[model samples]
Target: MKKMLVFSMLILVLILGACSKKEDASNHGSVNDGEAPSEFGSIDHGVDENKVGFNLTGGTIEEAANVPAEEKDLIIRSFDTYIHAFNNQDLDEYMSTLSEKPKSFNLDEEREYIESVFDEYELSREAKDITIVKFDEETGESQVFANLVTKMKQKSTGLETKRDGRQVTVFSKEGGDWKVNSVYYMEDQK
Candidate 1:
C-alpha cells in the first residue's frame, strides 16, 4: 500500500515538472527573434547567450547602424596593424597602436622593457576567437577578447616555442582613432 502511494506521488511530480515553462538562459529577454531586443544589457548585468557580445551592425541581427561601418573598420584595422607590426618586429609601428602619451597602460610600461623582450626573441602571433565584449557607441569605449597562439624563437639559438593564451583589451576612440587603453592577459589555455 505504501509503495502504491509513493508511485502515485512520483507520477504527479513528473507531470508538474513537464508542464513548467522553459526559462530563458539569456537574462530572461528574447534574443534572436528577428528584432532588436527591447533592452541591451552589459556583460556584468548578464549577456544574452545568443547575442553574447555585440551582433554589432549588419550581421545576423542587422543593427550595424549603432557601431557604424567606418568605426568598426578603424578598430579592426588598428588591431591588425598591431599584429602585423609585432610579427615583423617593427616597434615603432607597434607603439603607434598604443594610446598617446599621458595614456599609460602600455605607454608607461617603458620602451626599454619592451625592447629587452623583443631583443631576446623573434615572435609571431596567431589570433582566433576574436569578439567584441562590449561597446558604447556614444563614448566609443569598448572591450575585445581573443585567443592567441604566440610563437617565439630565441634569437641566439633559433629555438622556437609556442604558447596558447587569451587577452582582453580595453580600447577607446581618441582623435577618431581606436587606441589601446589597457590590456589584461588571461591564464594559459587548457
Candidate 2:
C-alpha cells in the first residue's frame, strides 16, 4: 500500500509538472521576450525541464498543523529552509537541510543538479498546493508532494523563465531532526 502511494505520487508530479510555466506571457517558446540571456558561458542545454525546485511549507490549515511535529511539522520546516537557502544561493546552508547523504532520482547526484540551478539562474519558488501523500510512523518516513511554480532568471542574460511541475520529497529522521532523504521533480512545460 505504501509503495503504491509513492508510485502514484511520482506519476502525479510528472503529469502536473508543466502546469505553471504555461502561464507566463513569454513562455510561448521565447527565452526572454526576444533577447537572449547574456553569455556567461553557462551551459544552455536548451532543455525546458528544471531538475531542481522542490518546495513545501507549513500547512496553513489548523487541522493539519495539529499533528505531532515529528511527522508533518518537521517536514515543512525542513523544506521551507531548503527552498529559501537554495534561492539565496547559499549552497552550504541549503545542503544542510538534507541528510548527510541524500539521494535524488539519481544516486548522489542531487548536489550536482542543484548546483547547476544555482549557478545558472536566480530562482524563486512557491508551493501551490501541498499534500502529504504518505507517512510511515514506525520508520519516520514521510512523502510530501506539491504543485510547484518557480521563476528563474539567467544570471548574466537576465532571461527569465517559469516552470510548473510537481515536486516530491521524502523525509526521514536523522539524529532526531527531519532531513530530506530524496527529492524528485516533474516539469510539465519542458
Candidate 3:
C-alpha cells in the first residue's frame, strides 16, 4: 500500500510538470509559433488555439507561386499605392485601392479622434519594413501586414516620444486589378 501511494504521487508530479511546460505548437501540426491559424493571426495563448473562419479571396499558396510576373507586379504596385496614400494622407487615393463597396470599420472614429487631438501631440512618423506576409493565387488575393513606428514629441519639455503599431490589409483581384478589401489597424501604447 505504501509503495502504491508513492508511485501515484510520482505520476501526478510528472503529469503536472508536463502540463506546466509550454507546448511546441509545431509538434502538433501547427505551422509556426508566430503563424496563428486565424486570418488575423490572433493568438490565444491560454487556449493554445487561434480564431478561425476567415475565407479571404485569394489564390491558393501554390497558385500564388505560379502567378505570372506581370500580374504579380500589378499586385505589388497596388500595395505600394496603398502604403503611399496612407503616408501622404491621400484618403481618396487610399480608398481607390479598396474594393468597391468595401466594408471599413475602426477608422471613422479613430481618425476623427486623432485629428481632433493631433495638435496636442508631437508627430515624427516613419513607416519601415513593409513585407508581404501571405498571398493566394487561386483567388488572386493577398494579405499585407506591416509595422509602423512613430515618434510623438513629449508635451511638457518638447522631448521626442515613441510609438509603434501594426496593420493588416487584405487585397483582392477584381476585373484584373488589385484592390484593398479590408484593413485592420492596431496601435501600441507608448
Candidate 4:
C-alpha cells in the first residue's frame, strides 16, 4: 500500500508540472492578450505585435504634451545626447548623460558593460517618435519614451543583428542637470 501511494503521488506531480509548462508556453509571445504591462499598469494600446515600433496610447501622450515646452525640450535633448554618445562609442560622453546615482543598475556595472560592448561590436542606433511620457517638476523627474532600432556588428565574425523595441528612459535632475536614472525596454514581439 505504501509503495502504491508513493507511485501515485509521483504521477500526480508529473502531470501538474506538464500542465504548468504548457500554460507558460502558450503565453510566450504576448502578455494579457496583446497588451504589455508597465509600471503604471497594462497598456492596451493596440500596438501590432508584428510591427517594428511602438506607439503611445490613451492619456499617457496627453499628459506628456501638457508639460512646459522648455522642460520637454531639455529632456529630449538629454536623450538625444545619450544616443549619439553610444553610437560614437564615446564612453565618457555616454556616462555623462547618466546619473551618478542610478536606480536601475550599478554605475560600475553599466560602465563595464558599455566598455565590453564597444570593444566587441560596432553599433548604430536610430531613435524615433521620442516623447516625454511623464514629467514632475516638483520632483525633477521625467520619463522619456522612444521607438528605437539598434544594429550591432560583431568585430570578430562580422555578424550583424538588429533589434527594435520601445524604451522608457527615466530621468532625474542631479545638481540641476537632467541625467538618466533608469531605463526599461520591451522588445517587439516579432
| Cα TM-score per model | 0.60, 0.59, 0.47, 0.69
What Cα-based lDDT does every candidate model obtain? 0.60, 0.61, 0.54, 0.72
Over the stretch 1-190, how does candidate 1's per-residue lDDT look in tens digits? 9999999999999999997656544432223323332110111223223323432221332223356667777777777786787788787887777777322233534444456658888888887766666668886676666677888888999899877765555578889888876554533645
RMSD of each: 13.7, 16.3, 11.4, 8.2
Off by over 4 Å in 3: 1-68, 103-125, 150-162, 188-190
* Between candidates 2 and 3, the lDDT winner: 2
Q: What is the lDDT of residue 29 in candidate 1?
A: 26
| lDDT tens readout by residue for model 3, 20-121 | 777764332224443423222221222211211122222222223455677667877887886676555555675577676443423443344444335354
Ranking by TM-score: 4, 1, 2, 3
In lDDT terms, how accurate is model 3? 0.54
Which residue window of length 10 is worst by lDDT in model 1? Answer: 37-46
Q: With candidate 4 superimposed using the best TM-score fit, by how many Å does residue 166's alpha carbon deviate from the native?
A: 0.2
Best-to-worst lDDT order = 4, 2, 1, 3
Q: What is the per-residue lDDT of model 4 for residues 1-190, given as tens digits with 9 covering 90 to 100?
A: 9999999999999999986653433232234334333321112233432221224332334336567888887888899999999999999999999988886556776777688889988999899878786777897888888878989899999999888777777799888689988776666778
Choose 1 or 4, whichever is better by lDDT. Answer: 4
Clashing pairs in 2: 17-164, 17-165, 17-188, 18-188, 18-189, 37-157, 38-157
| Candidate 2 lDDT tens digits, 103-127 | 4322234556677768888888888
